[model samples]
Target: MKQNLLLFSIGIWLFSCQPGAETGSTQISEESIKTHIEVLSSDDFQGRKPFTEGEIKTVNYLVDRFKQYGLEPGNGDSYIQEVPLVELTAMPSETMTIEGNGQKVELKVLEDFVAYTEKVVEKTSLNSSELVFAGYGVVAPEYNWNDYEGLDVKGKTVVVLVNDPGFASGDSTFFKGETMTYYGRWTYKYEEAARQGAAGCLIIHETVPAGYGWSVVRNSWSGASLYLDQTGGSYQPDVLGWITRDAAIKIFEASKVDMKNYAVKSRSEDFNALSLGLSASVTVSNEINRDKSQNVIAKIAGSEAPEEYVIYSAHWDHLGIGQEIDGDSIYNGAHDNASGIATMLGIAEAIANMEKPKRTVVFLAVTAEEQGLLGSKHYAQNPVYRPAKSVANINMDGITAWGPMKDLTVVGYGQSELEDIAEDIAKGQGRYIIPDPEPGKGYFFRSDHFQFAKVGIPALYASGGYEHMTKGVDYVDSLNKVYLTSQYHRPQDEYNPETWTFDGMKLDGELLMEVGMRVANSAEWPTWKEGSEFKSIRENSMK
Candidate 1:
């Protein structure tokens, strides 16, 4: 009787340990996620900075995890995709001299202005370059607006305002009305200036419209900046930078233009680019370094349509060691990305244990995301699986740590059908979907998913909901505000396993798994929404 009882107990334990045995559903292991986060965010990883020892450890760790999960190599016979990058550390002059209307104004670095050069040269100088106030510096034909209309800015410096007219005027008919479009992005301003053959671009930064303080701009752009190698040739402005509102006011005063009047007038479609009658003279010295980073790629090939793929992505790099703050130098990006990578591992493990999917599921851990999404951008441009063959891309960036919530926030909500799928999955999990809380920040274009989206692949980027289960909405709101103000991109973003909660992160991982599984099993290919900016790109790729 004792021997029979022992045998029966052993059998029951084995059954419970099997995947899909618990409640007839396959669940991601919370223990596995905890271990992954603790290890990835540990100080020994040195913040996982690209091209450093930290990056080497991070890539190895991810590759080992993928191998342990029984995933095949995503990039032909290799688990790594090399990303060639050029690191440019610009050392600008102490003072930027601006002369206008028989007056000279010197702007201080870090305090009054922040600037850099992307010219990839040892030394670059702007010797009395003509400065033109280009009013937002946008030329969007769709909006019937062109700030550079009938203006030739070649070899000149263009100064533009941050955000768009809709944000400034709060007019619904302007450009998405308070919700910043791509044109509102600072990157767009620089790119537009470069397209118009400008030698330099400076964005006037207002905290409200720019979404962050001047300190963020200083900290982010002051140090080493990396860009994908464009040895073949790329159009980039000779100088790119930002000026504080005070500095802009000073310049306007020197130029004899009412700064407030010009700001108000810029909102109108009839606004024209005004020559500031100012000349800028500054020298930029660069210390250039070339290195190779990598994107760790793994895959679970489909049994049937092996050519088609569904991608799961997360960036594994952070702002590495920098100027010490409060005796701490390492920016251990725990919530920024360690949580996302942990979630991706959990999903990978769950998928590995399931039956073969009908479409290939690729797990990609990209590098250099903090340095402008370089790894993902390279993959999107030179993909292992063609964009036309990919079903969808689901990216996990920073996941909420404040516990489970009642809703999920979808970034770029209406741009693709992937959101509909994610919405249904969230609904099944007893949660609803909400658009991004801060739409003017353009969070959708700020992640790795944007790279895939640009290549015509429908992508989904969502965050843990704002309404917490126990803490409620007010608590969640306060927590978000605190995080943005105190912890984001700072050395204080360390991992404290004792205080962290994986409940919401786990739920989000499960939802992503469900969406990916459903898309993989179905024959339908997710596409951009009918009127989405990416719709034409998708249609053309499919053709």
Candidate 2:
């Protein structure tokens, strides 16, 4: 999308008032970004997972940095914001019993299936629960689709597909086509099942739609699962899990149901729920621990309108020590988010060193984002700076490592006016703004920025890795492929000084600093674009 030159001119004049501010961005150098990433992604931090020693180390490091930089604690004299959470480590039966229609099959745990529950209890189980095939498990009224319109799954188990109906339907008008909406997310499916009073919800996982392999599911679900302490009696399914496509096919065959036919029918709006004529029984013993994780928040107070704010956010958590693979166990989230945290820190330091903007500028390092964006979600619900006062949120999830690129990949592009600002910044740096290369992967909703977006705060999540400065797009793609194939969410994602470069991150950090500074200084607030789902949210909240 081309930026309106008129808005670009206005933005230029708006931010040009910050005297010597361009030099502030230059202070975000490669050395600073590399130092932060190296320390955060090191094995000594133990993966930076919440509710562990890693959490303590990670949060303390952030707090210490903020103090050293002479920034104020964002949370009322305390840099730490406690996010209450419950960790449930489930020991499920080795096999799940699936039987009916004179046939029976045992689904192996961590192989054919992976299951766990978030209901903070010592034990939760589904006993002989009748199985029902629920298409997508969505009830999006705006789309006029309800997979459970006339079905009652109370005390039963639901079998839903990985993505929404538009996964491969190629109908752009339908559910945003291949770009997965919140309805397509597995988190949404489990929430919908619990809303329908179902005892269990199992999403059938396939590589393309689920966006990862079964190994990811096995490793993620094998460890202790964390949930924002649902102390107010919010209900969750007794059994929430995923079954490999092969396992789902096997179970469907045993129930005498044609899996292919059901999958085909599920893509249509007229499709209805069908009972699989099978009963699923699984028992899981849970070890529950209620704990608190810290969200490190530090701020540079405004020289003028201090109540209004511009925010920078990044999640500081990753999969702790997990299923050992390739003779390694630590899931050092270098690219997954250590890079993001590093970038945010670099930007924060640069901005703090310069003259303050009109509105406060905050840097937030949140916890449990890998768990499910829980820390940001909690902060959004209980905020020190109200959403209405927040001018914008600039989030960094992962930074490019294959050197600077010509294209700035904006995740969730066209959602808000923040993209327009990003466009101006990118053009100034001899780069162009482009939409996410893999929008179907739902990178926007997968990050902590979505939490801020949900509450009407315009957020920017953009990076430059699509078209490398010297090597071009194909070279960047190859490196990205290698990381996704081997190191993504795995132990191999460690800092290798010989291979990793911080020049690109330095490029991004500088631009991100300008984005926040512009928003903080400008009197005009950014808003969700006309067709965005979040438009009405800001409208209702401001009222």
Candidate 3:
């Protein structure tokens, strides 16, 4: 009953905000952010890999800290939300082979492409099934395009090229112009193929088109892949993987087709799935395991509208012990996500020390984000509060350890009114907002915010700026380019305060707090932009 009254009181407080005056300035301290980052990025955590001992240690630490700050459990009586996961590693029978019209080509997994099975079976295979070259493998009724039009893809392997045609054509008018929509993502392609009853799926990889090289895809997917246990979920393709362009050319030539013409024809809207006139056969054996992960949740209830909430999220998992490089076996993820988790905890501390918000606020440290956004997906599918009552999601993915930049880069910038709120808060501190330069990378769909977006919640996953002050923008860009190439997802990602700038991270945390706090105190809920695919969902949920 006390909790019920407190929630009702917070609702009352929102109407009492003094009009025509700047609400009192938030007092977020730099010392708090510094302290949180220091401990999270420390070596004792062993990179906080989910399903490992590190995860237990990390969750205990966060929950203990939340207690110290007087925060309540987000879920009744507990601070953890259990996320069930199953890890399956796909091992091919041998090398995957392609044969068509008296010609044969052999491709090795991990060298030419990385393939994995999503099926729960012990073994699966495809033999002599015809291949179909599906352009992007997208079936958008709204776009009046369907790659599977009149085609029975059952028991057939569908080959697709990465990204949308608009990416290469520089036609923003085609599909949100330069920005990558969900159609451009490889996961969606694979899902669509599986839904279409295709036997197998292979995505053709090009550096620019895929936003990364074949090596990245190989490294990320080659490890143990996790999926939610859907006892009766749609069947996954028998074979799933990617192939190099040269390898794709070999398959095309074997089919007695002009590789150049096939490539050019795929760029047109009228293009449909074509018979590759070849068959791909692969046998995959799986090592399956089941485990339960947890999402650590802490809350600061408001003085008034407790049912309404403002959420802040960060992923706590990183690549576990992997191939050793120079004897550093751990990928500490100090920068990839340790920094992000640290910022989330810091923001929680800052809020805990402030006057009570008008609405409840939740600080969520989710798991399995590195393994395809599992933790956040579960949360979105099973939210603590109805999606309509939640105000917004403020996510911190990769925070800058470099000193503060003059600009803040908002990923998926134009999708939400939250960006306007972010800009308002950023400008208040003499900083400016910038859109991501590499939108074609499909970064918006790559993080935890995407799970929330799928459920019609407005989310913002903004990271540190690559544009530096002392160094030129080009120099900053070069540094990121190098990180993306050598250090990302590699064992080389260790915490080195010497090379990092906490000033920027601290500033970013403050801006995030400001945004969340402002929304929590207001009666308004954010809306998606007009014409956005998610807009209608948000509108319906609000009603």
Off by over 4 Å in 1: 1-24, 256-260, 323-328
List where candidate 3 sits over 4 angstroms from the true fold: 1-23, 99-105, 256-259, 469-475, 478-486, 540-543
Alpha-carbon RMSD of each model? 9.0, 3.4, 6.3
Work out how many backbone clashes candidate 2 has.
0
Highest lDDT model number:
2
TM-score of each: 0.90, 0.89, 0.89
Tens digits of lDDT, candidate 1, 1-543: 123211223222332233432222778888888898888888899999998899999999999999998999888899999999999898988889999799999999889988897777888777899999999898876677899989999999999999988886867667777778778888778889999999899999999989988988998888789988876344678888899999999999898665677778888878888888899988888899999999999999998788899999999999888868889999889988999999999999998998888889999999999989899989998898899999899999998877888888898766777777776667778887888878888888899998898789999999775899777899888988888788888888877767688888889999888878877777777777644657777888999
lDDT of 2 by residue, 285-343 (tens): 88888889889999999888899989899999998898899999999998989999999
List the candidate 2 regions with Cα displacement exceeding 4 Å.
1-26, 51-53, 99-105, 250-260, 319-332
Better structure of 1 and 2 per lDDT:
2
Report residue 294 deviation for candidate 2 (angstroms).
Answer: 1.2
By lDDT, the candidates rank as 2, 1, 3
- Residue pairs with backbone atoms closer than 3 Å in model 1 (clashes): none
